[model samples]
Target: MTQPNIVIPPAEQQTSVEAGDLLNSSTAGVIVERTAQVRNGFHAEGRKFARMMAEFVNVKQVGVASVFVYEETFGIKDKLHWLIHLSSLEAYEAMVHMGTSDQEYRGNVSSEQVSQDKGGGGWDKIFVDGSMQETVLMPQFWGMYGTKVDGEREKQTSVYQQQGPLTGLPGAREQVPLPVEQLVHSGNCGLLLHRTAQLEYDFRSEGRTFAREAAESINENLPGEATVFVYEEAFGAADRIHWLIHMKSLTTYYKVLALHVKDERIRDLYFQERIAPERGGGTWARMFVPGSMVDVALTPHHWGMYAT
Candidate 1:
């Protein structure tokens, strides 16, 4: 990211004031400070809420001083304070009328003619007054478990510069595979994982029966023990599935089959049956009821499959 340009005007051309002048003058200025604890989340006791502080300024002849606070995070703007204007009753009324008629007014105050530059220049002795504090809370969670299929383990080892064979071919150098463990852990629900020999199947019908029929067809035809995972749309699940299958005779290695369905409910039902219950220790391979693999064997052209 490019750094923001910080333009500092010449000292001679800038205006300066003391805290006393700011409280007494009928002009506008801003009060800025560094804060380590800003409110975050819906509840108190949340993690670090640090923020840079800025207060909009509106000065008046009266003793009332109104300060509005604002904070920006992740490129989003949020209002943290209210419109405060310190002025006499008459002055307040006039400011309001001016604000209502003037097109250039940017301050949130209801009045016009009140100076809007939070002191336009800068001020000294901007002492800290009593603070208003609030507690903030943030929540997080995790789930799921699986082993990295052999090929992925090999690839990860190669990238990490671990001592390993340069290639998987036999009669060549036997590289040491990296030591990486596959385990179940808590995480978001929609992440996708890519694995070998499995193809994504897209169905075009609008009902659960159609999906079940398709699944049965694919399950029956593929080599026994071949792993298959079905997803309605790419990235629909937080963590995607990894399939393992053998296909030495086929030219294309991994097939991503697209199943187009007109009914959303049918697609959802299919997904739920195929991928939702791994948490209970039931194996995905076993989830394929008999006859699930029959569709792929019959309608090779009606479905679209891509190899990765």
Candidate 2:
């Protein structure tokens, strides 16, 4: 119905990582990269697995770099890499359980059932990391998925963009209709440029303020191709915000970056900056992650919104 705005960034801002000939998104995931432990049935069974998780909270898909996921936080990377949609923390206490055994704290299903329904069960392995109370998601950009009863569930909110539109189905939240240009009608999950980094102390305001500013001033020449979605980690680590942009090729990603660098925009300078003492907190500095990452999940199998 409407044509989405396309954004093709400047020439010098790109990281210059050349990609091979990969037919689809399935070959190259969007955000975080994963190890062997997190792939099997991760994306396909994502929705089904959420229904069975006890500490499950909100869901958000990611697109980013190989941010060197720590060995201690292996599972978080595992989940971030393959999950069709990103899943965050909810704090075990926040969840209501049906009870398995107890004098006072039996919890929901039995340890055996928990094992069976989860990793060992016939479903996808859902990962619940960190505590919700301690998790710091940026509030300025966060909002509850629309709930007018479009057949999606209230227990969990599914936020999908740049795929198709799949949040309003039963057991999920209503789809966030960002722009028609966000989704690719049939071939594969749209190609996206993902970037991520940790934020500094009390820096939420700065992050949001800059994002809004960038929205207006970043790259006005390019429109939908630069349609970017911002997100923060819900579990494991705190304040790791991810920015996923819609640009399909590695060449195009470089083009966006190159554009900024050639013009010597503030965006490129921030890319070299890191959070806190790591580097003088520039915009990208405070968040301090580098490189332009791409989406790497199976296309049709994990559509938030798709067409036949």
Candidate 3:
């Protein structure tokens, strides 16, 4: 198999504020998540597969892959999720090409001994048939998505590196020099909330505006405790938007919920949307497709890629 020549930006050149940000990519910060329902009694075995997968993929240097399992409190209780953070769509294509075509990756998966179980049938045995779903998201913020020049990407990354700790807002205090190595896999976030919504036709702009404002509100209220990111689907359902909320811990999750309920800024924004403009509020009712909201919370199952 012919290997694609891949150029990876040095860790220092990449900027990311979330668990999904493993490397800086050219395609507006791509995050590909694969979710699968695991067969009963195979949780441990599934985790082992996740570890192996992450090890192989990260070593290839095409991208970083981390495995997460759904928390019982949210989404399906028995599923494993793998999030692959790549530098670009091209990088993702290369990873897929090499993963399937290269003998190093294929040999391990196809080998009979890949599974430790006595009845070894390889790693595929751990999951239910036809339960896996993959979704592609491009992280977005402000009015713009992730479109950035090489120099802009590098500059943003550098700013984050100098910010020292998450609690310190940019330019709010003296900068602290944070090593690129340490910041790359901070491992501070343990839970990720995945929420999806579908916008009505002609209302995509309004939905995006609301999302941008909501994210800004959350950041202003919580600062380093929690972070909210908006993304538009690069693939999958049309008009579907996604939100990824990275929480420092389980406690932070509850704290965020409370903030949403009690914070005036958040409530006001919702009120404007729910009420009609004629009533001196927003037309949020018309902005989104009813019954299109979905929420799932994921917790780290293994630190395989990050550990390496």
Candidate 4:
């Protein structure tokens, strides 16, 4: 599909997904990275502000995701990792562009680009300026699966679950997945696990095979438990692949991690078998967005709740 080229005006306060939307675009989803310590009042406020802009500004609603990663290796609860999904890079830039406009920009667009345009950076008092750590994600090949049939029960625990349907993107509704509710259940909370590794060989040839093997493991053993995503680092610490796991329940979330830690064949493929080696730097985290954060969960028209 030819992605529409969209250039939103700064301060326009209206959303537009001229380029392909993120939920299912093969080449979309710019991992919006921000260095944030979990539960800081200002930082959390900044995230919510940006999300509000995306909800109100664009021609179509785009999601502002807060994906938190929990890695036992770090044992640092003070630092929190998160991902806010904008429709595209342009959409992100435009959202931040509001910072340079007439009104003060309260949202933390990226850690680096906080504006002095309004009161010489005083806005950080309410919302700290943080930089967007860059990353390379796998092309959107890992998608929602195990869909709930049309008349079956729907499971959605997203902050945006109550938000309207997705629009301006393929696979948002028609293909890829269906009614956002099916992607996850309502009572559940979400957790994201991002693991970055340095490849010893080309994953396209070798790593992919291992990934497939791992996927098969999930399907066979931990069925309907989690959604797995592998991302190649495009910006942060060079040469890294981030593996993201989105889970619905705390029960399944912990189970999958325990499974990975003990499983030998899966461990051999990456660790013992020598495919991708640790770069001595990576994080595994379980991100949970408060169900009360309805403002943060507001998503775009084309957004999907889950695969099933």
Candidate 5:
């Protein structure tokens, strides 16, 4: 059994060692290198994809969403600026209309001045004068004018003499003997004479004459009772007279009196007696009396009176 020891061949030994080395190299090198290459390729593709996406995002932020190829087809950039400025067509139209010239705008420029040179001078004056002249030529006008001028003048002269300065004084004449009976009767009659004389003198004064004359002319042919009375009495007296005359319509009478008198006290008295009662008390009965009768009864001493 010891005579033949088995000897391993060199070719077999080489084969066995080489096979083990091939196994180790496959495990450590080939698999790892393939995996690393796959991972690197994936990362490179991911980075390129992210960069492309970022380019599109930047274009959109700059108001150019599409690239050149898409922009040529869509015209997006051209319309973007317009869309931002004008929200709607109607708003744009309205702005345009407001900026345009209009007739009202033109009129505003022309209304600042009025001129006689603009057909408002000699022609207008001629027309007015002609109208006035025609009015004066009417029969009613002449009648009214004459009565106002002449009748008023006479009446006013009478008033001035009665209450004016001339009548306030006294004068004496040569004495003559009188009967006792005549003297007794004259006592009462003298007062009446004095009043009549004073009235006559007042009617002759300038202011009274003018007022009476004007009143007569204006009131001539005026269809109703025409009378003009003058007084220098206090407001209370004037109010009493107005109340009596304007009983039918205190407001109407008050207005007429106010126009003629020009005295504030008289106006107040009229308001107190006539206007207040009719307005506050609702007294229609007292307000319906004719002014003439009231005037006659309340102011019998007045300088003038006419029945109609």
Candidate 6:
């Protein structure tokens, strides 16, 4: 029996198969984000908390923790953010256990000693009560593409080999991962734009296809200037999808966004997506749930990589 010919979208043809699979193996897929609103008069204290996390707390954690501050976001002002990259869910579980068991970790972030001004647990003094929120995310597609994924293991191995023998010195026990720019020079990725939306129940696959194609088109047009990542909520709303765009700077983000209308490829894709199905157009808007979108902009804290 002969099969009939069927056309596939150009974006589908160009999409990387690896992008669709969850790379849950090692330090590449899972990201846990922590967010909190800074208290009205605690701006300097917020910075101190970030510095404390970067300098003391993050260094000892099982996963890498990089802190950020929200430059712009929906539903909150003066938000502090923490992005913890881990190997897997098992690692996350282990991290939680370690945080609970380690006395130093507890002392540094202890809610019990919130009133104290000088010692461990002063982190609570910086943020508003009941404003803390945490979300766990997995890269469903288009997640880890840069050297952060490619060279991380090799870099770690090389560092260990060079260490030879332990010598007592300042910050000797701590292992800090390389900054984003050093990992992938082309994708400096200093600023992050996080956009979240919910997909309609029936259009999950269609939404994924559209997002993959749109991301491909943007990357194709802009090249190394920007990159787009798609992540699905692992522990939150099942229908939600996250679109994370990484750019060298805010200026670079503006340039890439302008391409939606200015660039021929993106303009054509947009037009096709809006056209009717009877005219062989794309199906994009049909996949989205109304009024489920949120956008936030994050820049590195003064103590974090590529700090603003």
The TM-score leader among the candidates is: 3
Among these predicted structures, which one has the highest lDDT? Answer: 3
Give each prediction's root-mean-square deviation over alpha carbons.
Answer: 25.9, 15.0, 11.2, 15.0, 56.2, 14.7
* TM-score between model 3 and native: 0.70
Q: Rank the candidate models, highest TM-score first.
A: 3, 6, 4, 2, 1, 5
lDDT, model 5, position 27: 15
**Which regions of candidate 4 deviate over 4 angstroms?**
1-28, 38-75, 78-82, 101-189, 201-204, 219-223, 257-308
What would you estimate as the lDDT of candidate 5?
0.21
- How well is each residue in 1-308 modelled by candidate 6, as lDDT tens digits? 22212221111111122212211111244667778887766666676665555444334542333222333323455777766555556666667786779887677676443345544355666678998889877655321121122234434433334566522111101111333222211113456677898987766665665665676665555554566656677778875887667655666666776888578867776556643477445557677888887778765444322232
What's the best-to-worst order under lDDT? 3, 6, 4, 2, 1, 5
Per-residue CA lDDT of model 4 for 1-308, tens digit only, reads 22222221111112334332323212235555444442343443344444444444333334532222222222433233333444555556665665566252343333332235533333244442463243434322222222122222222322124367533222112211333433321112243344444534323234433443454455344534554544445445433444444444444556677777898865554454423345332212111112311111211111211110
**TM-score between model 5 and native:** 0.14
- Show where candidate 1 strays beyond 4 Å: 1-17, 24-66, 70-79, 106-308
What TM-score would every model get versus the actual structure? Answer: 0.16, 0.37, 0.70, 0.46, 0.14, 0.67
Two-way TM-score contest, 3 vs 6, winner: 3
Model 3 segments more than 4 A misplaced: 1-21, 24-28, 62-73, 113-118, 141-187, 273-281, 303-308
- Whole-model lDDT per candidate: 0.24, 0.33, 0.56, 0.36, 0.21, 0.53
lDDT of 1 by residue, 1-308 (tens): 22222221111111122333322111212111112222222111111011111122233322333332222112212212221323333344554565566553433322222123533211111212343332111110001122122234335332335367422111000111111111100010011121212222221111222322443333333322122222221222322222212121122123213222444543454455443244342223434333333211100100011110
lDDT of 6 at 225: 54
Candidate 6's TM-score reads: 0.67
Candidate 3 lDDT, 1-308, residue by residue in tens: 22222222212112232434434211235667777886776666666666566656655663333222333336676677766665556667777787779998888777653345546776677788998888987655333333322234335543345655432112101111222222212134555677888987656656776765676576666655566666778767776888776565666667778987888878787776553466455556577899888887766654332222
Quote the lDDT for 254 in model 5.
Answer: 44
Error of 5 at 141 (Å): 22
